[model samples]
Target chain A: MTSRVIFPHKVLPYLLLVPQIAITLVFFYWPASQALRQSTLREDPFGLVTTFVGLGNFRQVLSDPDYIGSVQTTIIFSAATALIPMAIALVLAVMADKVIKGRGFYRTLMIWPYAVAPAIAGMLWLFLFNPTIGTFAYMLRRAGYDWDPLLNGNQAMLMIIMAAAWKQISYNFLFFVAGLQAIPKSLLEAAAVDGAREVKRFWTIVFPLLAPTSFFLLVVNTVYAFFDTFGIIHAVTSGGPGKATETLVYKVYNDGFVNLMLGSSAAQSVILMGIVIALTAIQFRYVERKVHYA
Target chain B: MPERTEAGTTSRSRRSPWVSHAVLIAGILIVVFPIYYTFVASTLSLQQILRPPLQLLPGSHFLDNYYEALFGGLGRVGGINVWTLLLNTSIVALSVAVGKIVISILSAYAIVFFRFPFRMTFFWVIFITLMLPVEVRILPTYKVMVDLGLIDTYTGLTLPLMASATATLLFRQFFMTIPGELLEAARVDGAGPWRFFFDFVLPLSKTNIAALFVILFIYGWTQYLWPLLVTNSNDMNTIIIALRKMISYADADTQWHLVMVTTIFAILPPVAVVVLMQRWFVKGLVETEK
Candidate 1:
């Protein structure tokens, strides 16, 4: 009787995963296959005409200047967005971990930006940086600096980066703070007893113990930078100031939806998917091994 | 643990609390100033908003801007009222939240309790989808929506998102941590699986469920790309999409005041959700990570 009961409990986990499995197959695998198929065909506004072009779309995208620019922009955007937020969040998390009072208030306010929709975040930034009416623009003009993100490529990229990082800092902070808290309090005390200063204690005790949390945040933050900021770019810049803000996914949205070049867009999507998958696999295999999961 | 230090030594060893407070205050301001600026900007008129020196105080145009953006004025492109858009967004978000939670619970139970074939294979496949970004499969998913006649409808907007792999994975992991003796005791008491799930399992799983609810609600509410593609008409547009339309129009005409107002309106719902759900939200992340 005990064995029979134990067997069902053991097997139950697998059975419960069925709907997720089915949904993944239908919505994920089926669509992925369809995207792959559509990328090979010649698609017009009216309909798609299927023909196996044997990497023609891929070749066209790889050689195209616009595609190349998008790839470059995406690399820069992802790197900056990921690195900046991680740095800021790490510092904030450490500070928050040290403080005792008003922790909840600080956390609540810090995560407020994350609550705003990305499109809304873009719109708010758009208003704040408006050339004529924007408060930031007014401050810049008063300080003898020309502030026009909409007109300058570099300014536009910087604004987008700032917005993305601001939105993400709270999320990363939450994870980091939690990770910091989970580190046994005794470790820090032990370090302090050994004549370690604050900075030395953090470097020797806290940082080493927080490796797993850091790794998880790194993966999550990278994925977010690569895939989630399309809406932000769409609202704020729309790949504007001469397409300077056109990251890979933003370009995919343009080619696929706005321009109705479905095949080429699908091709771009496939390439992006491949890159993300490869990066993720490499991250898990190489970086995760370094994570000290206590 | 170290020996207890004298009070003087312990107090002297710490940095000045005032300095830490100052740093914290500065960080908090940087995090919160945008929201403050947004609210202030929404209150100002277009001309004042555009003036060389930007207005810092709350302006007289707050009601005017709100009225215009919500009801159409100053050459605003008119469509559904703000109330209607909020209602639509709420309906879609609420339904998606409920559907996702229910499905996640059941699916999690099945996986946690039953003997099933190809279980690990199934789990791996589901895990892989968590890595697949929505942009990759959107084209075909959009086609599926059109094929099933779900476009321009609430059912269409919320259904595809309902069966969330993230929620399932989360719940399954949480369920696995529950004590096995509870299930055995329930079985001995002659409770069926359904009774066991409802009576015993669910009560203990409230924290996880609450966390999942907060996360899913935010995800559903903030969904923009899919809703934009499927719902073409203004009547069907959720707040996020509606806000996008407002910004696009403002971008074309350079109507700063109206844009600010619409942006404020767009942010209110998600902000409300976050404030209400913050506790669960953090708890969920901590649970999942652990």
Candidate 2:
């Protein structure tokens, strides 16, 4: 929607737009277009020759067992990373909402973790759960639990997931708190007047009304798990225990930067680009319909 | 009594207030325990931490460990001290936050306040960038950095990161909410684009700018992967990347004491920012994401 009243300046607007446009073109568009182009081309190991191979990199990347395993890992990682924190946050938000006194105090304490860097969060958890030197790991072994995340793939995945989820809980908690606050009090009061029990009142009134916020957080937490948790994985597990925690983003970095498999990495990057586009589309669609809830 | 019961059920009485506080206190403990343990670990000696099930209480070596961490250079990271890493991180975070605000506000002003050809085209261009995070286009972006000779440079670390859509979109959304009459009144008084921007737009967006600053500074400070790839030298390392360097996955190679110390240092500024600017931080977060 254009503003009805606007300056009729010709060159000034273009001048004003230069810095953002220039940066976007150089850093964002150029690299993205290059990824597309590089995905179709292969460079020889000797760095002496280049050949155009149409769709071959995509074919190889898609067919590779390691790549397939990484995709499976990403799905599991993203789902758990998205859900665990969301569930924890929802419970905390509900509790905070119910408490009449010290609501702000509890919120302040809880939200501080939102500021902790994911890598730092991962490190804290890593130190606490490190099989040999970790405090909790010591407790676990004493209890007869086999707690070596470094040696077991599933255990390693769980560790990173917890670290990732721990960092995200504050974010989801804040959103859920905001969501809970937005529900009309009259609706709940009416349910209570009808002799609906507290749990029944919440299920019949609050949960249904909170669908929009829940849906929005779902999309956001999915995006966070997909892209932003790279730091936690890198710091905590480094996608270890036989690539068990190797997410799509981590694999892209590993293949391109570490292994120098540019063609395959670029193909994987293009596929990631498609995934992001799909997610962004869903988000924008939500934005269009968001006004109804408001 | 019945009236009080009804009133309580409406807002605050789904359960006893004690139950809510109890659950919330437990939640807070779970959230804070890792950091608390890290803090406890930071103050202890290496031998203390190396031994499993370290004491939960504070240690006697707090001053000594902190002194070493603040002044002592990590041997693995080329002896660059924590202070320099903190300074580097501050520069990156401040520059990214300020630079993004400047560029985005200007663009949003142009798009919202002026009638220009291809304006929607430019908006779409910036909007599409939301989908292309550094994770997806890692290699090509790094290539651009190398080709531009920006590797290990401060500009390299912060500039590529500033190329995002969130701030511009946020500014655009805020600008749209501004009353049209304000611009009309300025125009009638013969205020040009530059004058309107400085006098009306800038002043109007003061709170928004502050809010965005809090959020963006944290975003800049917490960056891990991009800085990891761009800066190879210890001298160029931000605090987050430096923390990663100081850590060794192998048990024996790592100094748990110093690592804990650096972890606290790494998190302090951003956490302080969030706590100090809690109101604006929350506002900026909800606004930008939604």
Candidate 3:
């Protein structure tokens, strides 16, 4: 991992590393350790007292109906967030790949959404879905649907999903386009010689070739729905119409910052950290395997 | 990977161009429509926005709406000027981007150039942090910020976020590609590590640094949950958080016109960066993730 002509100086290297290490120790490791330690201890409502609860916090969080519901909500949220964006992105990317006209123009126009803040994405969609002033809400009501995200849990969940998915589409579209472009033109032509139509060619050849990228995107998208969509939920639904849209990350924020449940939130954070570590491990593993092939 | 495929090319040319263009145009419309509506809304009067059958075209109130949003008078948004929020956001974004690049490149240099005890240890410590996003550890991190009295400060907003592994990893990967012969030659010429780094390494790193700056600046700009937790005062709010405040949804009188104006202002800088620096943006994102 090091150069052959390495610096023999000990203190200089350590000094070079000190700033990053110091920041990591203080901000990352310290808080992480605090979360681990605090997960075993319960604190009273006032800033005064604490009691050792051992694994009680974990038990409480794991067994809570609300927390269980959040896990399910996160799964659904992540799945929809992953699937919808990837599907739409794949469709768009394939279509863009087929035609040569205005190729760069289409790409530049489509990816602007990637630059919009997730919170602002929520705001944009929220404006469109607001019952009173929302254009879509007006259309929905005109179509005789009882459409109010404010009062409807399902509608709130859908709103956040749409907003989150919208933000992610450009990112997925870029990757999918990249992945699609990497497939050798010969393969598609080879399939064409065998009488495979575009649909058959895509299913038998292109789809199989995109497996690695699709898998990588799946994990990344899951982690995103778990974490990055915090803005979308916060700005759009705030985890409500009665906790219906509270993903695991939002629950950590709500329980810790809003409700002042330290031990519980810490336990939840510990769990979330574990989940992320696992996800990152999977991503890196795929990356390494791809590197080996390359 | 280009092929002649004369027959294939002819057949593909005969394939329906209308269908692909139609689907692509539809996709573009979905992606661009929200942003277009935001622009359209920002140009309209509040009465026009709330009134039924809102005009799809840009209205005559564009200057007045933007002027009000930039100055003040966003009702229920706590008297914070858009200028103050923009300043806070730019400061935090710049600091995070610059801070991350500086510290990461140095540590990467240390790891790559020197052999020391616990060198692997330090590498793992930094590398492991790639997984721990701020959202995963907000509470304890917030408590630490509170204890250190960093809460509600620019330092709090930027510093904690700067302990990033992605930049360090990116720099490490870039550093590995620097031919060892350059360093050997520098040493034979009696150049010290600092001199060699400044003269040779830093110049080589310029493109990488610029690309990374484009990505990290956007990362810093788009942060929401961290700023939402850390900055309690209106004065400390970033434009994103301020927009959230302005459009709290619970508030009935959320001057939609003004909020739309602020939304446009909030996203324009980063979107401009991404569009203008498309090459660097793509390179930074793709390579860093890998």
Candidate 4:
């Protein structure tokens, strides 16, 4: 994959690779291997002894009802976070693309939320929806709806979902805009000449053509919801209201750091790693084909 | 052909463009409402915030609230002022951005420019790290940090997160596009690897480097979970982490006005970078993923 003519350095190449390789091994590989090793080992109460229990931790974790609940929570959270913003973004992107004027203006105004930290975004929503003090909460109460995320599990999940989805709309909007632009105007024009209406043409032609981008975004958003929304969960609910908001990642942290269940946490870590591997593999398989779309 | 089709469509549908504009305007309002509400709340007095249906417009207490947040009016978080948190975040961001770029560029160059043994092995080693994000390896990674005595240190904050496989992959992809003639020409001029790297490669990669820096800086600035775990002291907290500490969910005495002010301060820098360097930010995001 390199050039035909290149440097013939032996030591310099290794020297150049040292920093990245070192950091990767120490921080990435070592910890990962440790997770694997620790998954099978259980420590005593006093932290003095580690007895090897092959597959015991994984068996216990899989059987635990709380772990199962967390798995369901992750599934619902990821699905909602992925779909809600994407649907909204597609609508906004189509409208932005259709508008003849202020296209760039709308894009500018809309995209800065991508830059907001998930935690900060969570804070904004929490403040606005704070039951006792929130402006929106006050209005909702006036409108005769019960409003309190702090006490209600379903409401808390909704709050984090809204915050996470809100932050991600800008990213999805950008990609959808790019995807729409990549479709050939000639195709739509051809459909028009054949007596197809605009909305019908979009459904039959444009929507099908955006399949690649849509599929790619599905994978990306899943990963984002899976890993990147840690801040939002931590800040907004801390997996509260009876662990309704704890995703797999949050559970791993809580079990490991907060609850001090080393073996169980390590097992959960290994499970998460498997999930990432599967998701990443799916992404690469799709993206490999989509690479030449340009 | 396309122009005629456009005219045909226009005649078939005399729908007002105002509808599209109105829809987009509504979308923008919803998207921007929370941010604007935060800013307005930051300027109000405690009484104003405590009362429901506070005025939509900003109150007259902007300077007082901000002054209180910035100074030690409310007892400083971890004895560190807002400025300290801001400074710590900036340092982490700049270091992570610069460090990832430098190391990734060098590794990419090494892989692309020279025929070294075990090259693919090393590449795969780095590639595998992508599957092992810090979230999945939280306990073990913290153990490693604790063992290495890097906890509560800047190195702990920045170093573990800097092994960027995506960045290296991007640089490698870009380097593969470099014209072979340039390297041949540099070789003819008797340029060493270092010389070619400094003179030719560095200059040629300026745009890519700039784009990557913008994306990575935001990534660094917005980090929460890692910093939350590694840094225990109040002074060591980044703004994102510090903001969490500032809010007391259970207490009636939580400083609502100051929390709002701190939220604005926490959001401004990265958002400013995104808006200011919009072109490169978009390009960097699109290119890196591919």
Candidate 5:
């Protein structure tokens, strides 16, 4: 925000800006613009024809049962991925926050999963739950419960959800730990002196103080579930058994890359982009509310 | 709030510590389980994996599986060895990181320090790109890559992914914190923008550069859909895509041992970066989010 003393140079700044702008235009903007155009135009799979369809593509996508189902899948998937990770991370963070012993070691052991790619997370779980080869799946069968992610939609959804949530726990945990540390120790001590129990102190004081962090993680985890978990669905279930795990992002990939339905896919992309923009707006709005809370 | 001190040395005081430890230990186990499974599975033979309830502990096949994984034991994916896959991945990851840092730094410098027309416009342009990830624009971006004749090449793999709004914003924020007196001093010495940037600004940016490198490297290394779409040849395939191909386990005769070995290989570099540079990785992540 500071307007610092400027070193006088007209050409140099433009020169500095060129590479990033050029790359952005060529890669991000041009393609984004092309998606906007393509969304309004239907194209055959052969790559030879085009027809301007306007809202027809959007209409088709909105009315399609598959698209409707995918929207539902996305909501469920996003909520579980967001809530489960945040809940686990909050508990772990609270527990870890209690003691100083082995804190660094526990953090080191916990946070490395943030480095695992989404697809790799899917693969890791895929092997663990493989009907015959997977250790956990084998155990499930041994307990007299039928377990086949490959065949069952609920099981497949659960598999991808677990993988996605597992990968995200580290991220949320790190943030929650940071948030927990940011809380003033004096406040907790004051609460204790007032005869407030640990549970009472956490629920009344700590949890309220962590609202901003909780809300931030909620948006981030939701956005992640929407855009980033495509790899999980793509690898684990490929939206399979019966389109059980096909999130909106996965549907976008499948429509364009797999099925070659250009118009529909482009339309879906526009809708997704709009959703993200709205989510960003909501984040900013809630962040403003948190300023008052703090 | 995780603990409370009782004045009378009550019964609840001593028992609370154990509860916290128990919960923390249980969390650590669940977090470490999958990676541990991968390591243990890699140490076992194929027969062990085929049967249900594989050994929980490491088996006796470590060298055999890792040797196979590293030395082309898996089937020919685009006719490339697993070693080549590792090499390609490293190249893509490093190039994307370095490329992003360089361009983003330059752009951030321009936008932050110099007053220029359309500066705010350019900043907003970059900001909007954050909302449009590769997932949404895959079709058109793939077409552009095809048109540019970059498919399956290193340029194709890293270049498109290098245009980063986050890195630029990070640099811009960091540069703002540098005192304006430095710029005044440099200007009074008759140093030009280019000279001052190289001698003054970049030196201050070293830690940021390193931090961004760790974050971006992991990002590029773990990319699934983009690299999967662009790099059609196995010779050009990164470890992630190669691993995915290896484990279409339902249809193919997946060598579970070798697959596990490759999983470790795929995970090692980025995880190494995170663990080794834990301080900077955390700092960089928290800063970027802000």
Candidate 6:
């Protein structure tokens, strides 16, 4: 009787977590474990018996030039996407902050791009960049400069980066606005009294205070650019005229779903997961220290 | 001296009302122009769209383009029905939103208000999952869905995403701000945990719940990748995927008009939701971040 009473008192709190645990196990852990298992095996179509390939699949995926190129593309894409949006967002936020009027209007307008779905965003841009009928293409032709993202690697990469950055600017703006708002008004007043100019005040006082928000956005944006761009890439270019836009996640989706290389795809997924985890851990450990809580 | 200077500075800093309106109007134009362009493009003919300098105004071909895009036509592989896609997308989004909110509230209540062993560890585990991208886990998730016989079903699209670690974390942080005395008082009044949760806690959390609802609804509605992977039939496909299929079909001959029409149709619902629920969405972000 005593044990029963104690059990209800003690375990009731933990019991509430049961739903979350169950869902995560089924959706997250089970699939993750299955992926790990599949990564180690060589399974053919028709669900036939699979042989243990050990590290063979990993070696093949890693050594292939296409996969190596994808890694390079992933790194460049992630870095550019993360850094560019952040820089643009920071500038916009500062400008918006300095403006004496229409703060709410600016905030709302700036965040508008985030509302559009990624696939639609890609389609929208694709229409704008269409070779035969595109507005931008027509304008370029008028200017005597031939423009076709479909034909050039550099242009394709630029298109992906621009599209990703455009969608992400709103998110970055939101966070930056929130971060800017969190700065105590008294500090700004004090800096103004100290004869610090607007730019100087921002660089020294405001920027340091916004570090935590920046760091958080950096990690989130990197992951987003790394993994979330798959849908856009799939919709817009399908990795393009010469596989110029194929990032790691895109390759995984292509191999697993389109190419029907389930085992090899699983191996690629594992490698992708490892790289992301390592990058995230390193960012959290190193960059997080610079964040000013106050 | 400081007081006088501060008052003078405040007076100097205040901008004229006209200036504020001008800034707001300019900002609004920049933001709304692309969407306006989309609507205009949707109304024009293919030839008009291809014309140099582009048509800045809406054309008379809106109905025809929309009709052809929605129903298959010459040079179009159109099998999509927009209404059906919208219904499917809404069903999936609503279920995920409701499921995620309920689960998150319960999990957060347990973690924040009660004394439980391994609580910190559990929280860490939940946080860790946030770092693990869905891309890495998609294959395994697909296999599990297949095993459960969920393929091409609404349940398959909704179930895996129904429980979000981010929501749980947000709720946990929100719950922590509530006073312990409220819970203790309810307990002293002979209220059990469930009764206390329903009677005392939930009513106070309406704003947070609403905010979470908007965010989750938008996230779920706009979800493309997983749904695209799982659903095979046009009947089962959501609006975003349907948009993608339409665009790909229009790729070769490049029917800009039809593509624009379908794109506008695809974007309308989510944009409506966002504009309508903007207050709650912004509120939720501010509250959770705090």
Best by TM-score: 2
Off by over 4 Å in 4: B1-14
lDDT of 6: 0.76
What is the DockQ (computed on Cα atoms) for candidate 1? 0.52
Best by DockQ: 3
- Backbone clash total for model 4 is 0
In candidate 5, what are the lDDT values of residues A77-172, reduced to their tens digit?
999999999999999999887765788899898987899999999989988999978889989998999999889999999998899999999989
* Tens digits of lDDT, candidate 3, B118-234: 999999999988877888788888888899998889999999888879899889888888988888899999888799889988999998998899888888999998998888888
TM-scores for chain B, in order?
0.88, 0.94, 0.93, 0.93, 0.92, 0.85
Select the stronger candidate by DockQ from 1 and 2: 2
What digit string (tens of lDDT, one per residue) describes model 1 on residues B14-80? 7865666667688888777787887888898777766646555787888888988777743443546
Per residue, candidate 2 scores C-alpha lDDT tens digits across B146-265 of: 999999999999998886588998898899988989988999999988888889889989989999999889889998998998998889999888887777535486778888888888
Q: Model 5 over residues B196-230: C-alpha lDDT tens digits? A: 89999999998888889999999999898889889
- Residue-level lDDT of model 2, residues A202-247, one tens digit each, is 7888888878878888888899899999998888788898899999
Q: Among the candidates, what TM-score does chain A have in each?
A: 0.87, 0.98, 0.97, 0.97, 0.95, 0.88
- What TM-score does model 5 achieve against the real structure? 0.95
User: Native-contact fraction for each model?
Assistant: 0.58, 0.82, 0.74, 0.75, 0.72, 0.49
Ranking by TM-score: 2, 4, 3, 5, 1, 6
In model 5, what lDDT does residue B93 have? Answer: 91
TM-score against native, each model: 0.90, 0.97, 0.96, 0.97, 0.95, 0.89
Residue range with the least summed lDDT across 10 consecutive positions in model 6 chain A: A1-10
Candidate 1 stretches greater than 4 Å from native: A1-22, A43-49, A279-292, B1-13, B61-77, B251-255
TM-score, predicted candidate 3 vs. hidden true structure: 0.96
Q: Is the docking of candidate 2 incorrect, acceptable, medium or high quality?
A: medium
Tell me how far the alpha carbon of residue A282 in candidate 1 is from the true structure, in angstroms, after superposition: 5.5
Instruction: Tell me the tens digit of each residue's lDDT in model 1 across A16-96.
Output: 565666666777788888888878877545774556786888888999999999888888988898888888888888877
